[model samples]
Target: MSIASAIVLFMVIWFMTFLIVIPFRIDTQGDLGEIVPGTHAGSPQNHHLKKKAWITTGITLVLWVIIGGTIVSGVISVRDIDLFGRMGPEGSMWHSESGSAAE
Candidate 1:
């Protein structure tokens, strides 16, 4: 693949990673139950947990962005190609005796 293609692939992978890392909250009860429920029920702990979860999520996102950017840039600089290139006859044994095989 080309450098551009590699960058695009990385972006897609990063997006998927972001989606998977973020947590979702579901409320089975109505708003009244959420605000003030009966005894032995859920409490403000959920809110606190959600806040901490968001903080951790934000940190993870920043770290991934930095790491991914570094890796993509390094790969682009070193390989000069985004993805692996097709192998020639010298690199692969599948070529015919006539050496006419092509990618």
Candidate 2:
């Protein structure tokens, strides 16, 4: 993938992980029986956002490395996942199978 694509992929992964981790180990007002007079019961008393963000970053980094490496190394390619056969027959200028550009 290009540099821009790699960055985009990382951002997407990070945000996804953040969303999934947000509710974990949370201390909601209702759960802790400390609901403020003006606040809803479901409101968080201690969200630990900073800690969750760091945890998300760590998880996303590991996922990005494995996914990015697969893309860069071409283990699973676009054509391989083409469900409707949109890419047509595979052809490359640099063919590793025959070790020649022109057959």
Candidate 3:
């Protein structure tokens, strides 16, 4: 893949991993029974964002390496996923064998 594509792919993976990691090991003020006067009870007592960010980065890096390797090795390709056989020369990006947009 090109540099731009690789960078974009890494970013997407990182953010997705971050979302998955955010809800884990969370400590809300309500759970801690230490709600501050001005803040909502559900507010995070300690986000540990820096730790989660590092974890997310590590997980995303591993995932990106696997996916990028597959892409480079052609273990998966657009044609392999063209379930309707709509990715050949006779078909446009969105066209299927019926000569219309793929469902």
Tell me, by lDDT, which candidate is best: 2
Q: Superposing all C-alpha atoms, what RMSD in Å does each candidate have to the true structure?
A: 8.3, 6.3, 4.6
Root mean square deviation (Cα) for candidate 1: 8.3
53 Cα displacement, candidate 3 (Å): 0.2
Candidate 3 segments exceeding 4 Å error: 89-103
After superposition of all CA atoms, the RMSD between model 3 and the true structure is 4.6
What stretches of model 1 exceed 4 Å from their correct place?
Answer: 1-47, 75-103
What lDDT does the true structure give each of the candidates? 0.54, 0.90, 0.89
lDDT tens digits, residues 3-86, model 3?
Answer: 999999999999999999999888999999999999999999989999999999999999999998999898898888768764
Cα-based lDDT at residue 67, candidate 3:
92
Each model's TM-score, in the order given? 0.29, 0.84, 0.82
Cα lDDT of candidate 1 equals 0.54
Model 2: weakest 10-residue lDDT segment is 92-101
Model 1: lDDT of residue 94: 63
Q: Tell me which of candidates 1 and 3 scores higher on lDDT.
A: 3
